[model samples]
Target: MKSKYKSIIYSIGVLLLTVGVLDKLWWLYICTIYTEFEECRVAYLSLFPERFQNAFLLTVIEILLLAVAAIIFSESKKAIYQKKASKILMIISLILFGWSVFSLM
Candidate 1:
């Protein structure tokens, strides 16, 4: 496939993956708005272990996808463009992963 097409496909994939993970966590935070602080804290703590496991799995998948994307992009004619796009994807993925880890504490 052409680099242009590959880049677009990869970009959409990354965006969708990021949004899917964020949406899950966002709903959890949204739920806290209606609950008592103590209750919320208890619920969050109880769910932390399970949520962390899922988040870790998602993070690993994101890393693997990003690595594959990077490799594909590197072989493209537009090296600079690919580099920038990959960097942006990496940064976004890292931030999401960091947030997931922070929430565990």
Candidate 2:
């Protein structure tokens, strides 16, 4: 396939995946607001009394990982475009990850 087409398709796929993930995350938040039955709530609710901090930390990590995966996919070769995309992605991911870890300190 042509590089231009490849880039477009990949971009759309990434965008869709990102949208799905974010929607699921939003649903989790919404569940907290809407649900009354304990069992109908989000997954993290069960851990509240014992592991709220850990759950919160893990959720952040999960979001970061999803972002990183999107970056990697967007940077990967499809045909001919994205020639420097991977390099740029590596730099950005490294910087962002570094900043995130630093913030956690």
Candidate 3:
């Protein structure tokens, strides 16, 4: 596949990961959080609490992972090391997917 197409796929993957992280955070708050939803809303709006910040950070990490995957996919076409990098990226992605699912519970 062309590098451009690979790049687009990488971007989409990052977006999906970001959305998943955000949803996981929300789900955690709903299922396990002690604060009321209304209180959470107020605290988040006024204080930008640590939990919210952590979720955003997780999203950023996912974006970085996807960016790395894009580079690996693009490079694999012309470099011998690309195959190894792709395998590593796939493992990382799988782990992240598992964590995301586990977070929902």
Candidate 4:
């Protein structure tokens, strides 16, 4: 893929990662803090079934896609501060993976 396209994909992947993290936080808050709501413990969490709401699987996919994006971004001549960006992405990926695992148990 062209550098521009690769950059765009990376950007979109970051946006998605943000959305996923926020969604998980919202889910946590809903189930924990809002325990008074019966639906929060029952239907809402499993409304779409495991295939759709499975955190561990989704986090794995995100991390893999982010790695691809980071590789493409670093290899591009137009890349700026590639090292810093790569480190930041790596840190975020690790944190996300840890959170995903913790959520599973």
Best by lDDT: 4
Tens digit of per-residue lDDT, candidate 4, span 1-105: 465576576676567557656756777777775556666754445645666675456556655654554454444324553556756665665567566656557
Q: Supply the TM-score for candidate 2.
A: 0.35
lDDT assessment of candidate 1: 0.55
Residues 52-92, candidate 3: write the lDDT tens digits.
55644555555555455545444543444346655555555
Each model's TM-score?
A: 0.41, 0.35, 0.38, 0.53
Clashing pairs in 1: none
User: Candidate 2: minimum summed lDDT over ten consecutive residues — where?
Assistant: 39-48
Question: RMSD to the native, candidate 2?
Answer: 8.4
Q: How accurate is candidate 2 locally (lDDT)?
A: 0.53
Error in Å for residue 84 of model 4: 2.5
Better of 1 and 2 by TM-score: 1
* Backbone clashes counted, model 4: 0
Across 1-105, the per-residue lDDT of candidate 1 in tens digits comes to 555576686666566546646655755795767577666545544554665645446555555554454444444324555557666665655565555456556
Error of 2 at 44 (Å): 21
Q: Which pairs in model 4 have colliding backbones?
A: none
lDDT measured at residue 43 in model 2 versus the true structure, 0 to 100 = 49
Each prediction's Cα lDDT score? 0.55, 0.53, 0.54, 0.58
Which residues of candidate 3, in runs, are more than 4 Å off? 32-92, 100-105
